[model samples]
Target: MSVTAPSLPAELAARRGSTVELRGLVRDFGGGVGLTGLDLAAGPGEFIALLGPSGCGKTTALRALAGLERVDGGSILVDGRDVTGEPASRRDLGMVFQSYSLFPHLDSAQNVEFGLRMRKVPAAERRRRAAEALELVGLGGHGARYAHQLSGGQQQRVALARALVTEPRVLLLDEPLSALDAKVRVQLRDEIRRIQTELGITTFFVTHDQEEALAVADRVAVMRAGAIEQIGSPEELYHRPATAFVAEFVGLTNRVPGMVAGGVLSLLGAPVPLAAPSADGPVTAYVRPEDVLLAAEGVPATVLTTSFLGAVRRTRVRLEDGTELAVQHGTREHPAPGERVGVALAPTPVTVAPAV
Candidate 1:
C-alpha cells in the first residue's frame, strides 16, 4: 500500500508470452531479510498465488519479482532472459494492488488508456486498446463513467481494465480481493480468473486467504518467515503438505500429541493407524475437523461445545486424557457441550506430523 508511482517509460511494449523464473532470489531491507533464497518457476500463462500469513515475505517476494523492490541476491528471469537488474519501468508487468488508485479526473476508458498514453502509445491506438480491455472486463458501456460514478466493483474492474490494457507479458495481483466485501470479493475473484484465462498471460497473485488462493490459482506457494515452505497445485498442497507449517497454515488442523511405534500410532494411549506408517516415538497427529467422523465404533470423547454451522456442525470434544479435538459432521445430530461422543477419520486426506 505504501508503493509510490514510478516514472513511466515512454515506449509501447509489445506483449509476449513470458515464463517467469525466480531462483534463489533474496531481498533484505535493513530490518532482517525480507525474502530468503527462494526458488519458484511459473510457466507461461500460469496463474500462481503467493499464499501466506502476514509478514511471511509474500509481498516482499511479489515486489522483488515486479521490480519494485531491489533483489539483494540471486537472479530473476522472464521468458528465459535474466532480468534481475531491470527497473520497475523496464519490467513488462502490469500490477494490481489491494487499493484501486483510479484517477478521479479520468473516466473508465481514459483510465485504462493512462498506461498506454504514458508509454506514448498513439491516441487512436490507445482508444482501441482501452475499449478492448474494458470489454474484456465486462464494462463495455461504463467506459464513459468517471471513477466516482461507478460502483465499488465497477471501479475495481476499471483498475483491472487499466492493468490489462497495458498488455504486459506478466500480470501481478497483490491481495486485490481483500479490499472488497465477502460477496463482492468472490464475484470479482472469479471474474479475475476468467479474464486471466481468457488473456492467457502469466500471472502471480499474493493472498493470505487459503480458500481464495486454492480456488483460483493454478498453483499455490505457501510462505513462512522469509522463505517458501511449499508450492503445489491446490489439491496437492491441501492433500499432501510437505511440512507441518504448510499443513497448519493452509487449513484448519486438530493437532494432538501422539507417539508412533512400528505401524500403529498411539493417540491418548489408544492405537490408531495413520495414513502412512512411520518410525516410532513421539509425534503429533494432525486430523482435520472434517476428518473427525463421529461413529459408534470409535474412541469416546466428551463434547465440550457444539456449534451448528449450516450444512455442518462443529463439535469440540475433550478426551479423557485432557486432549481436545474438533469434529465436523454433516448431520444435525447436535450433541450437548458436555456429552461424550465417538470420533475417527474420514476417507479423504489424512496426515500426521512428527512431534516437536
Candidate 2:
C-alpha cells in the first residue's frame, strides 16, 4: 500500500539518521529476568524489529533503550555517545506505547505539540510544527478533533504524529498497532513503514507477531530467554533458519519424523537434503507446509481437514503410519476429508532437531 503524507519542514527533513548500539544489556526484575547480556546494533536509517513470544525481553530491550527501564548492567550508545545514565526525557528518543495515552482534554494539534511545549519551544513555532506533523500523518484537517471524537485508528495516527513531532534521534514503537483491528493494523503498519522510510530515522519495533515483523523490518531479531536467538533478514529467517527455534517461530512449520544419514534426511519415502550438518540418527525435520505437496504417486495418506487461507489452501493429511502433515497448495485443488491421496515431499533442504 502507498501512503502519502505531507513533506516535513526543512529543519526536520535535514535530520540525519543516527546509529544505535546496545552492549551487553542486562535487566533483572528481582526473581524474574528481563534482559540477559543482550547485544544489538542498528545502522543509520535501519528498521529493526524485536520479535518473540511472551517473556522474551523484546519490550524490556526497547524500554531500556528509551531510558524507561533501568538496566542492571550494560550500556546504551547512540551516535557514539554513551547514554546509559540519561533520563527518558534527556535520551532524545520518541516512543509510542500500546495505549493511545492521549490527553482527553487536548485536541489533536495540542497533543502533537505536547513534546515541543515541554521542550520550551515558542507558541508560534510549536503551532506550525504541530500542524505540519498532523498533516504529515494524514490528519491535516482533523487537528481540532479530540481523542474521543476520533476513531481508534485516527487516535493512533495522532499518537504517531506526537511521537514524530519532536524529531528524536531514534524512534521506538512498543506494540503500537496491537490495539487496532486487523484491517486498520495492516493499513497503519504500512503507513508507518512508508513514513519511517521517508524520514530516514533509525527505528526499533517490538512485536510478538511474526507476520508483522516480517512485513516491515530490514532485519528481524528473534529473542528467547531474554536474549536474541537469531537475527537476519525476513527471507533469510524464513528460508534458512539458523536454529530449530527460529524455524518454528518465524513461519508455519511441520515436524516430520525422519532419519539422517550422510547429511541427508530420509523423510517419508523421499530423501531430502539437510540445511545444516546433523549427526546421523533419528530426528524430527522442520519442514514448511509448502514443501509437502499432494501428488498422484507417492506415500499414501488420507485427507483429515483443509483450511482456506486467502490465496492458498492448507490441507492436513494423515499418513498410513498415522503421522499428520499439513500441505499447502493452490485453492483450485480441494480434497475432502477421508479421501485417500498420494503425498510427496519436495527435495528441499530442511532444519532438523534431535528426536525426543
Q: Candidates' lDDT values, in order?
A: 0.83, 0.93
**What are the TM-scores, per candidate, against the unseen true structure?**
0.91, 0.97
When summed lDDT is taken over every stretch of 10 residues in candidate 1, the lowest stretch is 1-10
Using lDDT as the measure, the top candidate is: 2
80-158: candidate 2 lDDT, tens digit per residue: 9999999998889999999999999999999999999999999999999899888888888889999999989899999
Superposed model 1: Cα runs more than 4 Å off: 1-16, 268-277, 347-349
TM-score of 1: 0.91
State model 2's lDDT. Answer: 0.93
* lDDT per residue (tens digit) for residues 1-356 in model 1: 11122222223222335798899988887886588898999987899999998989999999998898888899999988888998988888999988899999989999999999999999999998888778777777778999889878788889988988888889999999898888888888888887777667899999999999999999999998788898999988887777778889888888888887776777655666676667888888777888777887777888888888888888899877788888888756888877778876665544677777
Positional deviation of 160 in candidate 1, in angstroms? Answer: 0.9
Clashing residue pairs in candidate 1 are: 283-355
